[model samples]
Target: MRQETDPRDGDIIEYLDKGRLRLAVILAEDGNKKRYRAVSEDSRELVLTLRQVTHALPKQLSPTLSHEQLGQELKSIRLRAEQLVVNVDASDLWELLVGEMEEVELSTLADLAHGEVSAVTCLSTASLLRDDTIYFKHRKDSLYEPRNHEQVEALKAELAVQERRTQSREVFLETLVKALDSTPDERGTEFDKVMTDPLLRRYMEMLLHLAVAGENATDTGEACELLEDLQARLDHRLKGHASRKAFHLLVELGHFSPDENLFLLRHQLPAEFDDVLEEAAAALVAEGPRRLREALELGARRDLTSLNLFSIDDLETQDVDDALSITRIPWGWELGVHIADPCFHIAFDSPLELEARRRGATLYLPDRRIPMFPVSLSEGLFSLQVGELRPALSFLFEFDDNLNVGASSIVQSLVRVSHKLDYEGVEDRMEHGSSALDDDLRKIYEVADLLAHQRMADGAVSIDIPECKVRVDDDGRIWVRQRRRDAVSRMMVSELMVLANACAADFCVEHHLPAPFRTQEEPDPPMDERDFEHIPEGLALAFALRRCMPPAITSTHAGPHFSLGLPAYTQATSPIRRYQDLLTHFLLHGFLREGRVTIDGESAHLALSQADAAMQSIRNVERDSGRYWMLRYLEETLDQVREATVVEYVEKRGDAALVVVHDTMMRVRVSLTRRVPLGEVVQVVVNQVNPRADTVAFRLAT
Candidate 1:
């Protein structure tokens, strides 16, 4: 008896070729692996294994036949199989065989289909089964497996979807190609009308998502395929990251703004409040006055509108949240720090409060501001504007002429701001300019100086570094102002806020209440004398000290803030700008009113985690967006050579080092041929700058 693996010369065979069934004629036996040398239907010569052969029909030809004769014979068999397959309904055959059995032999299937078991019928049956995506499958040998009803239905659905996707891709490609070729004038109104189609709109949205996520996009398969298609069709070569190419395409089609803020979108930081949040803010504005009057009538709230309270901030500041006051008593001076009461308006866990908690802090972008609260509330109704009576959580302290605190207290009060002053104006007048409050400004600076000396004596670490503030107007004009970090009026405001925060935090500890207490541990392996002796440059020295300090973190438990030299501290000053401050305000309010914290330690810890996560994203947006605009500034003034100070060298040979540009204050690594000493100022040219890519380079001026 002959084994099934044996194939006679010139036997007709059906075998798998690249996942498709192809008809082939066996020419000779290959003794190795028990495979055969064969000629396929396309007249291509190949070796086929016994496992790959789905069928070896009971038919033969002369072994001495020429190759052309074999090709002619294979073509005739293929033609007959094609003609027979026209009448073979795969689904109909499956319906007949599915209920009776799971599988049937190929020759039996061929006999069932054509009433005969021959090479022609078997090849025809195999061809029909191979092409049928649903109903039947041939895994191995000459067996045909009939799929169950459920499997067949699923396959049909999948096949239908694939067909629709194919058609959709074709239509989308045609529409995009036409749009890409359109004249600029034709693209504006008429092309926008074409984008009204839902399918095209979906494509534009996908591109926008890809642009925002950049290299981090998850659904990149379709995005990559779409771009590859575009690259094949377009005249100019597409380049750069896949996301940026999508961005370029969107800009070309007028679907996206050319200068779209991808950072905001990628971070999911909302640029504007929706209608619901606006309504919540509007409701707060409407209910604020009534609630203030009720609290005052209840008699725990103090009324200090008669006090000459004044706020100092930048000229462009709108959400002025804190003000200061001083008065002489028999033994000492009474100093008052009154903070605007936004937390008093927002109920705990309300939508507005939750949103504030989510934002963590107000994001100040170069060109715009995204406030923690809606503008109507943050800038208008809740801001401590001059001459307007507003509810405040006021911290009062009595200090001697030496500015030593004798006593301090916290109270919910009502106050009116008498003056709204800027730092520059106050700084100018405190020195010599004669203004009505010049004397008061001088006295406040003296208090600030006293507080600073006290903190330093308490082991405070002070590092002052000048920062460049960049602003872009609606007209697209860029203004860069260098701010002195230790200016007198600014210091006065800073020290006063620190005093209030420290005293409030002490109160929380006294009451054993949990709040958002900002804590910073001392620098590990703290900087010593040798660390400071190395850097002589003032800016570099200050920056190195800053690097030695550990970052401050917020917690539900109270602890020392080493940098501020405060035994206890909480940020309750900028409720208008920071969410954690507002939360602390809420905790303070409940303790002041009910003699207990409304939020437990666990709840406060949970809020801290959420706010910390949000604040990280906020910081990334601020840093990345800030750098982008700085790069843009460099691009704007690329012709000018900037003064860059050599800060440090990555290699001791000084072939590569980091430098800080004088005007932009951007620190970047530069390749250096000359051995530049530390703190040496060198003229450097803007060798390369691309704001969108967040890339910039500097080279020493030759």
Candidate 2:
């Protein structure tokens, strides 16, 4: 007798323990004695074993029953079990099941097997259950046997339906992805043929109408009314805000305007749109703009009063930049720093104001800009240009022993700005202790340093990341240059700007005006840890220990930005391009004049939300653009023998990984890593560079 294999789901088990029918292909007797059968037990589900009979058993009790036994006759029949080469009729079962029974068939089992195929396919023909309509795939808990024709047909029908539905969904998703990648023809128009096809359009329309009617419409007239009401409700929610407006701006650039863009941006209603839609867009654009400009111009026309005169320069434009006034008021000196009233120049419903509202703020990119306002206003009329008299809100801070702002006063004053000094020259004189602006400017720098130190001592973390400064020649070819922060060039400019911004925020909050403050929320702890994966095990642990201290408070009000370690941070310095700063200027100007901040708080809040979204979107665009250029640079450098250190390792999807080269932080896919430990120096030859994918591949050389 052959030894039995372990009885797995597909393994045949013999039950003829130690004699008589041992090794026999055990057959149980039925009413038709000509057919034979075997049975197996499943012990886990019941106290006594239950059997799955190989062939159909008789419905009635066998004559082997006795008088006493017949009174309590068993509901099931038992077959003498045995081991036989488990065989199943190939014609009766799927090939996927019994094909693996022999070495010849088992060789290609992976290719032949499918998720839905049965395991009985591997069995030989001798195991046929022809007299009984046997179910090769036995489902537990089902009482009805496959011997019943209706049950067999029902199970097959369910499987077929499910397969069809799954295939249809997959086809639909593939088509959608393809459509996303498709570009329009030379005419720059893409028709939604699949979506707007006559048949699909009619079906969709019917479904939409049915859905509306189901929500309490009694008759056709009532249904139409309900639909109109629902449409109005949806339109209100879909009204485009700054974020969606900016997205539409991009779509316009791409030559593809979605429905959301059409509905919200009626002003840019394509020439194709009927006159009604165009008029509606124009009206919306006009309303908010008209109000904003009326307010701005009112402030701009005023003159500075009750303040000592300061030098003013008239640049070719009058867009307010900065205004200064010095006064010896009573016991101490008062310095008035006035800014232009942009809110005055921007009308509530003007096109320029509407565009500003859409953009939230100007987006600064490496090579270009998507400005928040039209240049005519941002850099011209509303600008507090050098030598031009413009209205501004002044902050007079009284300093005593330590030069700290002990007492402060805010005023709305119309004053002319002195010469506009760029950071480069202003910082140079201060660093050299030059007498260009008196020693007073040097004293300010000294106080600023002290403030920065205090911030760092309070557990602020500072990470200095290098940026690749690209200098593009006239031909548009980039010259990669290292842009490192210098004390006078970068740090000083940053500190003063922060000081201004912090002051502005304090002013707004103290007066109960809703101001858009720039703040950063820290990443979650788990994500923070994951970002350090490429670091060496030892160094990573050291970094983790150093930064393990919990932050005192998640929110910061005043003092140095814990992130930058600078005291008194704010950014009111740039009004020409940034709308937030311009708006801040407006609010400050209003508070100076009225003793309280003016402008709609709700509108300001909406503007802030829109600006943040635009900021993120622009950042993504910048990062991708920089990466594209970096890849191009690497492709050019591939031929030269370049020395690099392994700075990091990034795990890519299966069978692939990225190795970042030190200094440049450029990543390359390397095909070998079985022996190389992370951070260990290994030479590599650049094998291929794909500029299109923005990726490079390298061969690891020992």
Candidate 3:
């Protein structure tokens, strides 16, 4: 049976393509065979088909435009495109031309429209044809095409879904903002409601996106202004977890205030001294004293408690690591340098030892301190406190009346400090010559003077640069004080400590113990004497010499320390504050107790490497933090004209000369009209302070 169906020209119909209905237009039909010549709306091509045609109804076609009229309209569009400075919406033009043409004619019009617009607008023809709103929507039976009666319902359904989503988002934003403006209790309730609403959750994600985008904005002022505006619109304080995250993002973007506390951020400073370290310290403290007492009762320690041992340090110092004692001998006076024995309790690879190794060294900052060990251990149990019997590593050096070292020996002993004196108090006693310990203090000073002279003769360099101590008081006010470089009390302590370290190093080398040695190679080619010819033999000379010296380094093998005038050197004092010193004590203690070194060369090297890396990291943090605090201090004293020494004159950038301030240890780019010589004292007014960037700027005082 040849059943025939009638379809007129321009009648939109659907044909099967792999079981899916695809839109096509009936361009022509063969009545005799029930075959039709149809053009697909998508491809705009004629095809002969016997497949079933799907249609709702035929749409009434508008009056067809003559070829001349179509050409004129396309020419007008091209003229407008050429005159246009920005992209314009051409949907209205598409609507006027879409319904009046046959499928082949529409295709020709599309090509003309694309070519003319693209030539003028610099848009590709492919881009114009692919845009759904511009060209694809005009096709019959398209989801977006208005002329398709069947697809119009589908378009309305899709739009309704989008409109609902937009409405829900607007309502959520409004509600959240209003809640932020309300009281705290009301705000909490509103926040809970917003978070619980599934429809509003998507908008919350939008807020995050905006925050991240603002953080990454190159224009900081614009970004900050935008963030402030958003905050005002939301009426939120940006205080919760999400707000904190946003704040950190802003910091990462370099948009933070100068006073921002960056050290609180994770990994900004070492974390090995955190609360986890406190746990390990507590465990060590609990068992350490008992073990020391057991060792002492078993005759494992030489009792030197009767000697007049005393420690001298800063007024605020608590970790008394080293003390001095003197006894009269026939050939010479025996000078005993007793260092607190933390290694007696902290075994190698133990939790306390590992924590100490991880910390490497104690960090002292203007505002705070990160101690190598907990105060309960470093300052309490292991400190050589007055009247407390503590185990120590004693270096006994016999010095003749001429202050020449006769012999030296390292011994483990139990000692009780007679007094805990501060540097100022000791200095006062030395000046007045009235204290009970005056004679002993005087003899100590004499020996220190001889030791200094001996080291100077041994080609050792000494830089007597006074350190500027920046301290923050309890009231948070900063004070900078120059520590006296030539104080007799300081020299006495330093010289004795040096002697102890040198003796410890000699002991390690003699016993063939595996210990990390501090070594400094001799300067190559040596420093030119002409560099310091103009400078007086004082601080300036020392500073000039310091610029020529190489940095000291640590290694597993023993080597000479040219700066300390030692054949070999190892830090055995201050075990409470330094890991290397503690490791030295460990090696010495093990050798003394077990008759041979306990740590193998491989283990010593590995530990030394880890300690060296950690120390270097800590030093970097210390330097950066110091600069940060110094800038903070300058912020408080901004615009004040202060006396400063031009340590070095760096490049002249425009009208400014970069100089390092001797007092504050800060580098400043100072605006100057004339050249400034190095070491020239000038008055400078601090013009700007940026603690976040660790920078300060200055202007020459008129």
TM-score of each: 0.90, 0.46, 0.68
TM-score winner between candidates 2 and 3: 3
lDDT preference between candidates 1 and 3, better one: 1
**Candidate 1 TM-score over all chains jointly:** 0.90
Clashing pairs in 1: none
For lDDT, candidate 1 versus 2, the one ahead is 1
Q: How much lDDT does each candidate structure score?
A: 0.83, 0.44, 0.69
Give residue 274's lDDT in candidate 3 (0 to 100): 66
Clashes of each: 0, 57, 0
The best candidate in terms of lDDT = 1
Ranking by lDDT: 1, 3, 2
RMSD of every candidate to native, in Å, equals 3.5, 18.0, 13.1
Predicted structure 2: lDDT: 0.44
- TM-score winner between candidates 1 and 3: 1
Model 3 lDDT tens row, 1-702: 111445566554545667664445555566657677655534344564554653323231211433344334334434554454234334443455456543422324334544342323322221243343323353332222323334445655777888898788668657756764577567666756766888776555444443434334343443344345546675555543343445543333234432444443322446445677688778777887687778778878998988999899998888889999888899879999999998876789987788788878887877777788888887888999888879999999898888888988889999999999899898988888766588889889999999999999998888887777788787888888777667889989999999999888888899888788889988787766786776655444556677778889888799999888889998999899999999899999999899897898899888888878778777776776677777777888886778765554455434455455666755566766776665666788887777754466788888
Best by TM-score: 1
- Stretches of candidate 3 exceeding 4 Å from the true structure: 1-260, 264-280, 287-289, 537-539, 651-662, 667-677
For residues 1-702, could you state the per-residue lDDT of candidate 2 as single tens digits?
222221122223223333321111222333343322322232211111113222221123333334334223221112211121132232244433443332222212212422122222212121232222334333322111223445556756876776765564344334333443465441122224434554333322332343323333243453243334433533433224223322332243243333221211222211132354345444544463464345446764345554433323322223445545445445554445565555544544345555555565554433444455555445655566555545455555565545455576555555555556544554665667555453544554555575566656864554443445433345656567653444443554444455556678777667766665555433335236465665664322333433543343211233334465434344565565666676566666666656775667787666656655655555555565566566666676776554444433445334344455533455566665563554555567667876434467677765
